[model samples]
Target: MATDDLVVPEAAGAQYRETMPSFAQERFWFLDGLVPGNAAHTLQQSYTIVGPLDVTALADALTAVVRRHDVLRSRYVPAEDEVRVQVDAPRPVDLPVLDLSTEP
Candidate 1:
């Protein structure tokens, strides 16, 4: 068998409109179906900011990060046969700011 003889059915240009989900994603989809509204698989981080903090700048930075990463704005579609990951176009993200500095 030659390398040129091999062909991929899903191959379509440099960008992919939709692709099959990875193993991890498939597992997550199954888990989600088993138990909806479960946050066990979610990852979160917290940080304490000291002194003068620019909330607007922070929100802007976070939104920029979300826009840069396609996975951040992706949607997983589970079909009867398989699961697919669809990446949406880059768009501005809504970042809410909280003023917890006034707390005692």
Candidate 2:
């Protein structure tokens, strides 16, 4: 029934599952569902630049960071008994544009 966190197809070999979630990870995961849309545990910042940002470079940087850190590419999977981390290889991502330029 579980499809490797629904990211990897069941036909795509065996999914790699890491160890169980840490205390902090478990706590945060619980709070995430208990308080959806809460930003208390999140860190967000905005930047103002004078020129257009290289989206390609930004994507590459994000992918690189994910590749370098296995935790970033992992998610907790709950099953019949316990929860474990499922880590997958980094995939390419294309940034989406809002095109708010025309908005008044």
lDDT of 1: 0.71
What C-alpha lDDT do the candidate models reach, one value each? 0.71, 0.70
Best by lDDT: 1
Task: Give me the displacement of residue 7 in model 1, in angstroms.
Answer: 15
Clashing pairs in 2: none
Candidate that scores best on TM-score: 1
RMSD of each: 5.8, 6.6
Q: lDDT tens string, model 2, 1-104?
A: 34334343334564554556667877887787789779998888997655778878988888788778878878788766556667766676557857565689
Q: Each model's TM-score, in the order given?
A: 0.63, 0.61
Worst window of 10 by summed lDDT in candidate 2: 1-10
